[model samples]
Target: MTQKKRIVIKIGSSSLTSLHGEISRRKLKRIAEEVVELKEEGHEVLLVSSGAVAAGYRKLGCVERPTALTEKQAAASIGQGLLMEAYSEYFLSHGYVASQILITRTDFSEEKRYKNARNTLKILLDRGIIPIVNENDTVTIDRLKFGDNDTLSAKVAGLVDADQLIILSDIDGLYDSDPRKNPNAELVRDVKEITPEIEASAGDPGSAAGTGGMKSKIEAFKITMASGIHAFLGKAGVRGLLLDAANGTASGTYFTPAEKTLDSRKQWIAFNSGPEGTVTVDQNAKNVLTAHTGELQAEHVISVSGRFKNGAVVRLKDENEEEIGLGIINYSSEQLQHFRELDEEAKAIVDSEGLVCRIDVPLPATI
Candidate 1:
């Protein structure tokens, strides 16, 4: 079997729908056609699409974004149908099958759900089906939301270990500053690093239907790039943008990956799962974790914050709050406290059964 290269393409609401909040069939067809061409080239493709709310609002006879959550949900409920119909029909014409996968932020919030989503997506790809993904706006709360499709696309890219994440916006590429305001703002063709300084150059959200703008795109780029997935932010209307991006053209601001694909798992661990709790370890604990040794001992811990059940993931940090490592805790926060009081033999008995009760001496004393 040939090694498959995976690509994630995200289209902004502005790129998919008209300024008047209607789905543009012509635009959708063009985008689908380009994607079909990519699939013909034997690359696995996943599309993260927006424009559901915009489509829903138009169908419901509303001309503006709804303020109420129920109204927003209603819009999404109505729009998701219209969006998938278009995608399914278009792909069908091209002799390709497109699968609609509506995911909520909750799916990626937990490990099991995230793994299930990944496996499902993999099955779709293996069957030579293009998976069209959108966030489940109808059922998600603001706290469990991806905020916008940009972040959703990046997370999806990481989940699939995509080789590249192409973000299609209305702009040709990201500029050094908001070109609309600063006429002197230069078009940055390529971005090697996404520093806070570079991020400050991004503009605000430009469309009422779209939640993310250049700023969010930059954030997505930084995230995907850090996960060893290259990200390209470019204009969507260009006739061959997708093809160009896939073939490695000097188009848009390309953020190169800094790590290997295997390293992305740890990067995902570091960035995705919010640590359940923090373990403030003494100097000795800090040294052990930094060395990437085995389990941490109870004697090395100074304090534990937040309730963490056994086998829960926790952050090991120094007294200064700098994170040293993240690992599954051998004992819960409450259990570790009592376990630490045991003597060497007693502690060893508990530790030998996959517990941590031994404490190593800390590093040099700080004056």
Candidate 2:
């Protein structure tokens, strides 16, 4: 028997829509059936699907996908419902229940809200219900948006600590070069580390229906791999594609996870939380922070910039003003400055666990 796994499937707009920009029922049904089979096989599944704009633009009386932000948001309001209805209908036919989860980037930025979202997903997945996730476009401003479903899916996979993330796109896999222009471009089937060369090979989006291109896909993989989750990227609608992906038999790009993964708290601090202030440390301070050997002493803090409350995430920079890492600061900006004038015994110490280094994350530490 195959071992049960938790999988996050990200279906792109192009994967679920016709070339004319309308959602295709035939394609949706096929995808739903595959998801049902995965569930029957005891694999827990979550879907971060992108099709709201494509499905609703026509209903909004737009001859094509809208370019204005308000128009796009309006289209999403209409399409989100229709997309869920189709998913629920198909899943219900198979005796499975499907639920909708709409989110904006703001939801993840706040720690309490982030945890609440995770807990909710835990309940749904525990009860054998399939959760359909998407960006809440109707109210999301550009500044607070996740940008694309590709990145959102990765963050969701990390949030749930899923066993694998399967991203279905118009393209089958990453290529060594631009296949459209290079007749001999080769598909990269297995990727353990994303090198500069691999990054250079990635290009712009190929489908007019989708927002993310190969670049965003690579960025998504970085998030998943950092969280110790394996991932697959492939063309959607291939027969048994989801199953093959879960079984590790798919003909597409595969990403291997790092040996060590970030813990829940650090994962959030590293990927989700936004930094509010900046701290500049001397070389000695940088060394101590990176070594994970001790707490950050007040004497080492050369300067603090920006006003932030204590316990906020702060960007740490070195004497030369190069960014070194991020940390949950122990002191407010004013407090940090005030402590510099205090006696050695009265100084505040930022604990080792609060710091996150730039080169690689330290083991369970905060800077």
Backbone clashes for every candidate come to: 1, 6
- Candidate 2 error regions (>4 Å): 341-367
TM-scores of the models, in the order given? 0.89, 0.94
lDDT of every predicted structure (CA atoms): 0.79, 0.87
Q: For residues 1-367, what per-residue lDDT tens digits would candidate 2 score against the true structure?
A: 8999999999999888887888899999999999999999999999999999999999999999999999999999999999999999999999999999999887898999999999999999999999999999998989998889999999999899899999999888999998888989999999998888988998998899989999899989988888889999999989999999999999899999877677777778878888888888889878877876765666778888999988888888888887777778767889778867877656534333353223234422321
The model with the greatest TM-score is: 2
Question: Residue by residue across 203-285, what tens digits does model 1's lDDT show?
Answer: 88987778998888877876786677888888888998898887768377777875533254454454566568878878876
Worst 10 residues of 2 by lDDT: 358-367
Report the CA-based lDDT of candidate 1 relative to the real structure. 0.79
lDDT of 1 at 333: 82
Candidate 1, residue 172: the lDDT equals: 81
TM-score of 2: 0.94
Residue 20 miss distance in model 1 (angstroms) = 1.3
**Model 1 lowest lDDT segment of ten:** 358-367
Clashing pairs in 2: 353-365, 353-366, 354-366, 354-367, 355-366, 355-367
